[model samples]
Structures are given as structure tokens and as C-alpha cells.
Target chain A: MSSHSLATRTEKTEPAPARTRRTRNRGWKPRLAPLSILRLLILFGFGIFCLVPLIWLLLTPTKTDAAILGDFPLSFGTFDRLAAAWQHLTAYSGGILFKWMLNSVYYSAGSLVITIVTGLLAGYAMATMRFPGRKTILTLTLLSMVMPATVTVLPLFLEINAVGLTNTAASVILPASFFPFGVYLAFVYFSTSVPKELLEAARLDGCSEFRAFISVVLPIAKPLIGLLAFFSFVANWNNYFLPYVMLSDQDAYNLPVGLGALMAGSPALHPERGGSFLPITRPEVALAGLIVVIPIALLFLIFQRYLVRGILSGSVKS
Target chain B: MTTSRRAAARSSATAWAFTAPYALLLLAFGVAPAVYAIYESFTSAKNPGSLGLDSYAMVLHDFRFWPAIGNVALFMVIWIPVMVCGTILLALLLHERVGRLSSTMRLIFFLPGAVTGSAAVLLWYFMLDPQVSPFAPALHAMGLHNSIDVFTSSHLAPIFALVAFITGVGQWIVVMFGALQGIPEELIESAKLDGAGPFGTALLIKLPLIRKYVIYMMILAFAAALQIFVEPSLFYSITQSGSAWWSLNQLGFAFAFGQGDFAQAATVSVILLVLSAAAALFLVFRTDFFKTEVES
Candidate 1:
């Protein structure tokens, strides 16, 4: 099937030499196609639109606040100033920034484990097995996706506080783990791609149901796993409101929430507040933004192939 | 018969085992809190002795309520269409230019999504500032000279929409592009064989084929847009000009934290919940969102 699709793709992308000659004889001056040019121009325009802010962000951490205001927008400042900016950022409240970074990883990794395990299992079950209340569970998952996460925050806070777990990491991890979207994605992939005969063949060989799932289903779910892990990790890592509402203690704050507090406390972001003794400034804030963004960006770059392949194969198989 | 019945029971047990952990978590976190919120929304915080719709009435009467709703409505009016249409157009364009170029551009487009939540707000705060923005010259050319001109209350919706679009439209573009890639090459080739140009093929063939995914994207985008909190709240904190309750979610937060009224907060949540869920339910049933057997 994949080869068939590949052949079709190649044919569509690259027309035959005979056909090209025939078109040339027909006076079809398709060279320098206007539409392709327009497409490239639009794509590049959108590309610049997306990258300018990121480029600005990357350069911001290197400059002093004065340079940010006085110098050219895209100009580079010295590494000396970059080092000074990092120092200022790290100096904020005696290196709380590092702690927030650690907390972000801790929370995201913990929740990712649960999201994958549960989402994969449930999705597999819903796809393959005929069980009572299966439709109900699926419906509930969709309904859960419909409601915005913000609607649940205060209530989640109330429930977590009622159980005396508000400040702990579990308060954030547990709620973040309720990823209905992952389960739905898994369900779609399994139902569409995974052949029932494979599992049945394994079961006939005296493998238990769970064993067949582990051996037969999981081996082909690499793309699904990649899709789930990257998304769950990014969602958990970048999530600010839940962690902010749940964790009141500054030490327990994740990078995003920590950044918010840093902004609020900074004299630089809030010029209305005028000057203060705190060293947190635009460069420091920009560095903090980079710190929050770099890990996820690195993850995306590293996993870009898997992520795209996952998306492609997901629908291609269907 | 007995043996087959036993086998059926055993398989059911195994399936339950596989799904049990997730179901339990969903019940504990998703359903339980939602139910609790529903109960709280009906019960008054001020007069717990009486359980009724007084909180809803109080919320309805609050002067900030309508304006907050209006603000989010305006944001939605801008955000949802731009996101859905922009995603589709960009995805179509990316699909047009296949191979290494498209892949690299797709990655470039998706890069902004990584800078999300409060970090996005901070980045945009600078990005919109006329003096220091990379678009400083453009801002000056447009006759805007300072932060005040950029951050005005009148400009809040568009600014937030632009920020959301920049940070958002990428992932959806990627998703929509994937859906487009799913289109059987034969179908597109056949359409081309019939002399359909790129525009006609995209508008007529590709668009219709990916209709389900588009609807799915639109529904999710609408729900997310309705919950616009972090951007507006962060902006309000930094600017200190827009009302603290600039959006519905913030209004809910203010009701809960600012006034110590969980009932009013839950009232706001319930309103949003119903709005989004109703919209979702309508769309889901109108389309094949739940049909496991999708026709490829």
C-alpha cells in the first residue's frame, strides 16, 4: 500500500518526459509557473511572519535593555551582555528560575507517563475490544474535550484542596494527565491501521490478551507513541494556568508560572511601576522566555521527523 | 457454549483492565470536579443555607459581565475564522509545494507554538511595543509611536487575536496539512487528468475530502478561543489598564478569587461549559466525529 502511494506521489510530483515533450510541442509554456511562484512567495511570507518574533526572541537575551531600546531591532549585542543577562536572570530571588525549570520537567515527565500508559491502554481497548459501556466512555472522552480546561480549573483546585494536595506536584500532574485527545488519537490510529488478524494470530499462539497487546499492538504504535509523548509533554510543560492556580508556593512553580510571577515582579516589564532595586529587566525576561521555550523547541526539532511521519502515516493508512 | 461464554467474560475482564486506569482517572479528575462545579454553581456561597440560582442572577446583574462576554465574543469573531481559514489556506499551500521545502516550512510554521502560555504574552508584549518591536519601522510608518498607542483598549481584541494566531495557527496548519496529505494521490491526479487547475482541485476536491478534519479543527479552535485567559490576564497585569475581567475566564477567576464566591465562578464556568459543549454536540452530530468507521 505504501509503495503504491509512493509511486502515485512520484508520478504526480514529476510528470513523465514524454508528457513534458508533448506539452512543450503544444506550446504550453508552463516554465516559471506563476502559481508555483505565488505559492513560494506566500509560504515565504508566512515563514517570515512566523520566524521574525522567534529571531527577535533569540537576539533579545544577548542584548542589554539599553541596546534593546537603542540599537537596531535585529542587531547582535556582545556575549558579555549575554552573560550579564543570564546572570541577572539567574540572580532573581537567588536562582529560583532553575528550580522552576526543574519543577516543570518534574511535573511534565510525571504526567506524561500516566497520559501515555492510560491513553494507550484505553485507546487500544476501545479500538479492538467489544466491551460494555465502550461507546459511553468514548462519548465522555469527546465531551471532555469539548469543555475548555479553564472551566475545570477552579473546580479542580477546589477538589485538590479538599484532598489536601494543592501545593504538591500531584495536584498538577494528575489533572494534566486527563488527556482525552491522546486517547481519541490512539483510538483512531488503532481502529484504522492495526489489523485485528494480527492480534487474533497472537492470541491463537497462547498469548494472553495483554501479552498480545504488548507484542502485536505496541510494536506498530511507534508513530502513535511519538505523537502522544511529544504532545503530552509539550502541553504539560507549557501549561501555566493549572500550575499557577494549583501551586501557590513560589518554589513549586513551573517555568511558565514562574515567568509570569517574574514579569509581574519585574520593574522592566511594568514601566508604569517605575524603577526598583530588582535586577530583572527586559533582557532577563527574554532569557527566561528562551529558557521556557528552548527545551520544547529542541524536542520538536529532534522529533520533527517522527512527528511529521506520525501525522502523515496516521491518515495515509486510513 | 459454556466455554465460549467463559471466554467472552474473560476478554471483557481484560478489556476493562486495560481501560480501568484511565476511566478511574477521568472519573476522579474530569467528571468529579465537573459534577462538583455543577453542584456549586447551583448552590450559593453567600447563603449556603439556600440552594438556588441566586449566584447566576448575581452574575447576570454584574456590570462587568456583559462587557467581558462582549470582549470574548469579539475575540472569537476574529480568532475562529482566521484560524480555520488561515490553517486551511496555509495547509493547502504547503501541500502544493511538497518535498523538502514544504517539510522545512512546516517546521518553521510550527516553531511558534512552542512559545505558548505566559511566555507568548511576554513575547507579544514586546513584539507589539512600537519603540522596541522588530516591526518598529512598520509601527512608525503606520503612525503609532509608543506602547500606549499599541496597547489601547480598542486594540486589545485584534492584538490578542494576532498573538493567538501567531502562536496557534502553526499546529493547525500542520494538522490540516497532514489531513491533506491523507488525500489519495490517485484522486488528486484523476482530478488533474480532468483538467482541473490547482485552485479548482483544492477548492472542489481537496476541500471537500478534508471537510471532517476541518470541522474537527474548527470545533477545537472554538473551544480553545472561548477560554482565552492567559493572554488577556497577563496583558492586564502588565498594562494595568484593561479591566481585570477582560475575558469570561478571568471574570470567573475574579468571581472565585477576588470575591470569594465559588458559586459565581462556577456559574461563569457552567455558562462557558454549556456554550462550548452545545456547540460541540451540535457539530459532532452534524458530522461524523464519533463514527469509528471513517470512510477513507
Candidate 2:
């Protein structure tokens, strides 16, 4: 339960039953016992449970619009149909989906950098320095982490509108850049990972506290910085409610809001919305949905270990 | 000592300087919104000084508010326990000695989790679509004749809860699996040596050991369920019930965007904010998060 164990992606499973250790043992490999069969069956069942829908989703764009409903759920259609889906998706509102992707990257990446910088500075200070309002700030930051996002979206909308910053990318990026979770993560990482003696050593060598943090602290804080950056990017990239409320211009939306628009605008989904004339079919929406998800899927596949580690360490204790 | 005092003052100054950015951001975005929520919740849009608790009262009496609360309440009451049990069961299965196979299963289980709130809802919508759904036959089997019938008002409670539970459980499983992996190999070995079977060992020892983590997921789950918006919004095809199927968040958002009712939105948000604060305070106190790292 220590943070060290939590950091590892795979826990080296200890050999079960000491008898299984030696190849020279006369004992045969254990038979497929009833329990083992049951376990494997259950595992297979769970596997199908989680994967089928996702596979079904990925296959959607391959089918023609009519086939999307007529074909069996798991059936595959031609690549020619997939091309059609892609073409229509790209043509929607002169390729608005691409802009949403760009905006998502823009907002999340900007927020990620800001969150990391502010979080590192604040976390390092909270953990290592004696600021006057340190305790109060720490308390509030933790409180903010748990507050449901909707609670803030209302007033944040009002505040941004008050300054006439609404409908701009900053309206989304600026609010998101203030990441309480990132700040808290940085605090925990510094507290656990960076020894106070290291900072003290720098101070004794005539280094200023701020200078030491930049010169010494940040150098060794790469793992934490990477973790915080990843978390911030994911949180902001996937953010829906903030940008949904803040941005009025469809051109400024991030992936989530835009995907919501794409889904709702589908001619098949809502005939009442008057988008039936547009080339927005069920298949096109599916393709656009895939476009929004593919990057996140790739990120999870590559850095799943860190993502899992980050979530567990932040949520649970030893 | 005088020079040291100056040095100390300067060090404190640096600390303040370091924290100032986040502190200001937190104030402007966090505390300000919350303070504004309280302010706006008491006043009407027409007049700022009307100091009547109309919004809060209206929040209570809003026909949509009560059903929205009921919808979420029903979902939480069922979904949290089912999700907890399902996640624990999966963690325990993955805990067994099935080396690479278990890891592969873990990977597969974790993939669905990467799909976030709005996307997950949309993906599931296609899966549950009557004509397109693989579950079409299953829906028919349940005496639910069509896809529309499946997403009908009476069925909204179960359908929304099912979507949340199915999609949300994977992340929690991965989290609990991490906690389960933290259990020492010797504990399971000793239980086996004592002639305890797998069930007894998992039931009596492993589950109890990870009970704190379960409760942790539960608290997080409770907070998450209370904020259910993205799924419910996607599920809100026909808003005849207006706010009936809407979670607190959907209701709040609708008030602001759909109706131009900022006061009502702020009122609901303040209520949710209070609930969130209570959960957060409980989490901080229950765990070792607040103590000095050295002590932990």
C-alpha cells in the first residue's frame, strides 16, 4: 500500500504453492480443475462483457447508414462505406470536427502547462515553505478538488461573461487551468518523493529557497511533473460541462461538446432538429466519435500503468 | 539572529510568492463562484437586492427538481452497491494465479474506462439503439418490446443506472485491483496453510484487508453519482419530464442554458457544492491524506 508499490504497473506475483518452483519435481502440472475452469469461464465472460460494445462502436462507421440499423450489431460492412462515413463527417459544417479536435488540444494542452506550473510552485511551497496563509490555502485546495464541477460552472459562466471573455478559448482554458486535483497531486508527490533534507542542503549552500526549487527540486521532480501533466491533460481534454457552458461558438468547442453536437445533430437520431438535410448520418457521427476517442485510447494503452498508478495513489492509502 | 530573522521573513515571502498564483486562481474560480452561488441563489435575475430566498424555495418546489433528485437517488441506491460488488469480484478474480492472462484481462477491462463521460454515453446509446442494438433481442426477452420502450420514462431509472454502472465500474476495478495487489503474498499463503479454501481466504481476509479501499471507492462513487450529467443528458431524448431524468447537474445546466435562469442554476449548484464539500471533508478525515508525509 506504500506509494512505492503503488507506482509499479505490475506487482510481481509471488509463486503460488512452493511445489511449482522446481522443473525437476516429479509432480505433474496441476490438472484443469473445476474451479479453474469456472474461473476461466468467468474471466472470459467478463472479457466479452467489457469488449463487445467497444468493438461494436469501432465497427459502426464501416456500415452504410441503412446498414447501421439493418445489419446485425457485430456485422462488418465494406471499406467503401467507411470512406463514405469519413467523407460526410469531414464535410459537416465545413469540417467543424477538426476544429473541435484542435480546440481540445489547445485548451487541454494550455491548461496542462498552467496546471503543472502553478501546481508545482504551490505544492512545493505548501510542503516546504512557511507561507502565512499556507494552511488555509491547503484546506481550500483540497475542498475544491471534491466539489462537483457543475457547482462552479454556473458562477464561472457569470464571471467570464462579466468580463466579456465568454465565447473565447480562454473562457475554457483559463478556468480549467486552475486545477485543484493537479495541485493536490503535486503536493502529495513532493511530500512523499522529495526529502526535506535535499532542500535544506541547498539552503545551507547559500541557495535561495526559490532558487533551490528551480535548480534542484524541479530536476528530480520529472516523474511527478509527468504524472501531473498527464492527469491535467486528460481531465481538461475530457472536460465537457465547462466548455459546454462557456463557449457559445461551435467553432470554439472542445471534443466532448462537439461530439455531443455531432451526436444530437445526426439525422437519424433527431429528425425533429432539422439537420436531416445535412449529410450527418448515423455512420458519420460514429466516425466523428471514433476520431474524438482514438487519441485517448492510444494514450491509455501506452501509459495505462501510470494512469492506474496515478488514480490509485490519489484515491487510496496504505 | 537579526539577519536570520530577515532571512526567515524573505523565505516566508518567497513561499507566499510561490503560492500566490494558485491561491488567486482558486479564489477567483473556486471561492468566488461558490460565494456568487450563495449570493445569486437568494436573489432574482430582475433585481439583485430582492433578498428573498425565492430561488432556494423554487429549487425545492421545481417539479423537475424533486424527480431529478429521485432519479439520481434511485440510481445511487442501486448502482453504487452493484458497482462495488462487481469491481470487488473482478479484482478478486484478477488476483488469482493466472499470470499473463489476468494482466491481459486487466488491460481489456481498463480500456473502456478511457472513454470519458459524454463519449461513453453516446457509445452506449448506439449499443442500446433498438434497431442497431445487440441487446434488441434481450430487450424483447424482457417483455420490453421496442428500443423506445427500453428508454421510456418508467425505464429511465434502470437504464441510466445500468449505463453508469456498466461504464463506471471498470476504472474502480483497476483501482481496487491495485489495492488488492498490494496485499502480501504471505497472507494468502498462510490462509491456505490453515486449510482455508479460496472463498474463505478471499471472503475473510482479502476483502476485509481491502475494506478501506472499498469504502473509499464508495465515497467517490457517491460523489460521482450525485454529479451525473453527461450520461443523463445524452439519455434525455424527450425532455417531456423536463428535469425528471435529469441529474442535479443536468437540471442545473438546463436552468442556466435552456431557460436563462442563472439564479435557479446557482441554487442547485450550491446544494451540490455543499454535498461535495461534505464528502471531501469526510474523505480527508477518513484517510491519511492530511497528515505530514513523514508521519504517513
Candidate 3:
């Protein structure tokens, strides 16, 4: 029997009329069913929900505070207004906004380095090696992945304070490097994606396991590395509570804490707080939010290709 | 025999060497602070050296404690399942049509996550206001005429749930879509050959295949939601409608920074840690999350 008839045979258990309907609708251009239309509408609604606020945000910096309150929410103002907003934002506290951006870079980069090195090596060992405490380590990593950063912030502050390291950049970077999620991601990737036979073949070719990992494994793990780096950088860069409690000096603050402090001082966001002489109005605040958002969005776009392939090996066979 | 034994010993040594740095970090940052938190929870300022349960009693007795728990419970109830279901459904839709349009939609969904932490709360503060929000028409239609109407205590749960879902569901879509892609094509082809339609294939084959991933997402999302701090804290700052102690972490912050009661703070932290640990450990151990070997 032909495959088409066999397929129909498999569908014989269904009611007779439904089978004829299915066969009749089996052509390439199936009619647009109600379900397909509903799916399209739902997806279009999702698109609008996600994009509208971002579009609003992108336009806010271009407009004046008065325009932001008065004009159409999606309308754009002028480049002159955007430049003015940037000028007012940077002029606050002697360009502290730029300093906060730099501080964010330093802390995020430092932690990213540590997270990648330790997470990659440990994940490789757990996936490929026969170690005594591997299961315990893996379980602990899973638990730690879900543990709230707030739960540890106070205790970590106390620990760092005891070591006389509070208010230092190390206070943030050191703790942030303990990224159990990145390690877990790497573990999942290595165990599922990398074939054991490849490593074994390398071993038989007179390659030390460590040498093989450095040579053969590292080359193929580029996408995983990118995925790990992107996640670690985002988490460290956007982290607020840890740095908020750890760093007391204003000069040491990262973007989130700095912007928060700036907002607290502004009368626009906090109406109860009286206005200051600083020119940080609604436009300037929106500009600051954009400053904090642009880096991660750029990174996401650049590394997204690697992201899809990074987890693509979820069920790959050896 | 001697060579193989020596090789085994050498390989074991290599494994330990590679693993030591991360182990030490976990010990220092993860285990050490938790141990210190336990110790601090028992030691109070009234009796500096003596260990007691007074701090725990103090935290448990606070009137704000239970309300905070209830608020978080309500938020989680509204947030987690909606976020999970929305993520899976959106991912399946995106998987249905693989083209430039779907890729662009994916990018749009993930865009909100870029403005995370306090910035996200800040953005949503503006976005929910009927006066300036792009959704002003919708807000007015919903009978929220101003910020006052927008931020009532009764409305905070859904508002925060929407915010969290918007910012979070995108990343999981990427993840779930990847999980869908990981299903071997032959299995799907065979199911198709059995005359299964798209909906049946999704429900019967794809959903079951990604069950473990969904469970994993739920556990982690639950643990994260249990300690909802940034949304409530930032919102409280702007609105001042609710008590400052609106969530567990906020309460803990009040004890630690606001009142300098480290003991009480540590007690709260310990309670949160235990709750999260119990939930996580129970789920992780119950599932195949730690299974090193994949059958495929």
C-alpha cells in the first residue's frame, strides 16, 4: 500500500467524515483555520505589549518634560531637546553618571572573567570526570541557582565587612562571581552536547585529558562560552541590591543604584521629595534609564545567534 | 593493570584540580554566608555572646511578617503559572513559523529584560500611569484615571505580576523554543506519519518531551518569586501607599539597614533561605534535574 493510504489507515480509528475532511484539506495551501487566526492575533497582541513601552522609552529622551506630559505618548521631539537632556544629566554631580557607567563595566567585567573560568572548568569536570563529590556539587549548584540574592546580601556584607573589604569594588565582584546558574548552564551544555567518544579518541591519541579539554573541547564550546558570558555580564551589570548594600561611597555606585539615588533626589519620580537645583527632570531621568538599558540590549542582539545554538544541544545524541 | 590504575589516579587528580577553584568559591560565597547567617540569627544585640531564639521570635512576631508573606503568595499565585504557560505557548507559536518575522518577534519579546532591576520598576511606574503611559487609553478604559487609581494596594499584585511576566517570559521563550528544537526530527516525523495534526503533535509529543524543562522553570521561578523585593520596595518608595515592609526582603532590609538589627535581619534571611532551600531541594531531588546522563 502507498504511504498516503497507510496514513489514512492509521486515521481509520477516527470518525468517517472527519477522515474525508482531513484528506480533502491535506493540500499544501490549507485554508486559514480559526485557530491559525487566533494564534496570529495572540502573537500580534504580544508584539504590541512588548514593543509599545520600549517605543515610548526611546521617544522620551527626545522630548522635553512638558512635551512628555503633554504631547502624544509616541511622538518624537527634537535632537536639540535630546542633547539638552544629555547635557543636564551629565552635569549632575560633576558627570557622576559616566563614572557610574565605568564602575558598572569594571565590576561586570571582573565577575564575568571569574564566572567564565570557574564555571567552564568545573562544568567540564562534572560532565566528563569521575569525581567523588560531583553529585553533591551539582545538587548544591542547583540549590544555589534558585537562592535569592537578597537572602545573601546582608550576610555577604557582614562577611566582607569583617574582612575589611566593604565599599570596595571587590566586595561586589567577589560575591557576584559565585554564579551557580552559569555553572549549571555549562554543565547541562557539556553533558548533553559534547560527545564522549570524541574525548576518548583524543585520549587514545596520547592526549592528556586536560590538554584535550583545552584543545578539542574549547574550540567547539565557543557558543557556550558566549552564552555564559552574556548571562553573567547581564546579571552582574544589572545587579542592584548587592552593590546597593555593599558600596556606601557615592563614587563607587553602579548605574542602577546611582540612577535610583538620582531618582530619589528628583521631584519628577518622587513627587513627595522637594525639587533640587539640579536639572534632572522627566526627560533626563528617561535618558538615564536608556543609558542603563542600551548595553544589555546591544549585547543580546549581538550574541543571540550563539544563544540559540548554545542550548540547541538539549537532547543531542552522541 | 598498573598503567591503567596510575592513569585513573592521575585523571582523578586532574578532576579535583579543575574543580577546586569553583568549590572554594561556593564555600566562601555560598556556604560561608549561610553559616554566618545561621550564627547571626541566634546572636542578638541584647545578649551579645549568648545564643537564643529571641531574634526569630521577634521576626515571627512582627505584624508586617505575615502580611508580607501573603502579598508574595498572592503575587506568586498570579505570576508563575501565567508566566510559564505564556512562555510555552509563545514559544510554540514562534516555532510554528520559523522566519524573519518570528525572529523579530523574539527580539521584541526579549527587549524588556534589558531594562531590569530598579530600572524595570522605574519604567513600569511610568508605563502604568494613566497620564503619561502609552497605555493611557487602556488604563482609562479600565477605570484607572490617575496614579492614585493606578497604584492602590489591591491593584499592586496584578500590576507587579504583569511587570514581572513582561520582563521574564521572553528569556524562557527562547529557552523553551530551544527545547522544542532539541526534539529529534525523526520522532516528530513518525508522529506526523501517524496522522497527528499540529495541535495533537504539540500536546501529545512536544509538551511531554519538554516536561522536565517546564518543571525546572517552575521550581526556579517559584523560589525567585518567593523573595520578591525590588518591585515592592521600589513601588513603595514612589507610592508610599503600603507599608515599607511589603515583602520579605524589604522586611529583612528594614531590620538590617533601617534599624541595625542584624540578628532579626539574619533571622528573616534564614527563614527565607530555609523555605527556598526546602522547595528547591524537594523539587530537584524529585526530578531528573541532576541526572548526568541523557538517554537520547
DockQ scores for all the models shown? Answer: 0.57, 0.57, 0.45
Assess the local accuracy of residue B241 in candidate 2 as a C-alpha lDDT between 0 and 100. Answer: 24
Candidate scoring better on lDDT of 1 and 3: 1
Residue pairs with colliding backbones in model 2 are none
Top-scoring candidate (TM-score): 2
Tell me how many clashing residue pairs each candidate has: 0, 0, 0
TM-score for every candidate vs. truth? 0.91, 0.92, 0.88
Candidate 2, residue B241: how far the Cα is off, in Å: 7.6
Q: What is the Å distance of residue A150 in model 1 from its true position?
A: 3.0
* Model 2 TM-score, all chains together: 0.92
lDDT of 2 by residue, A188-243 (tens): 77777888888889989999777898899999989888888888887888898889
lDDT of 3 by residue, B59-121 (tens): 889898999999989999999989989998998887665556666888788888888888888
Report how far off residue B261 is in candidate 2 (Å).
Answer: 2.9
Instruction: Give model 1's DockQ, 2 decimals.
Output: 0.57
lDDT of 1 by residue, A1-318 (tens): 442243245335533433553454347537537777888899999899889998999998888888899999888888998899888888889999889989999999999999999999999998889888787788888777556676688788778877899899999999999998788778877876798788889988999988888888999998788889987898899998899889989999999999998887788887666778877889889999999999898998898765555444333333
List model 1 lDDT by residue over B178-202, tens digit each: 6676677789878878977778889
Report residue B8 deviation for candidate 2 (angstroms). 1.6
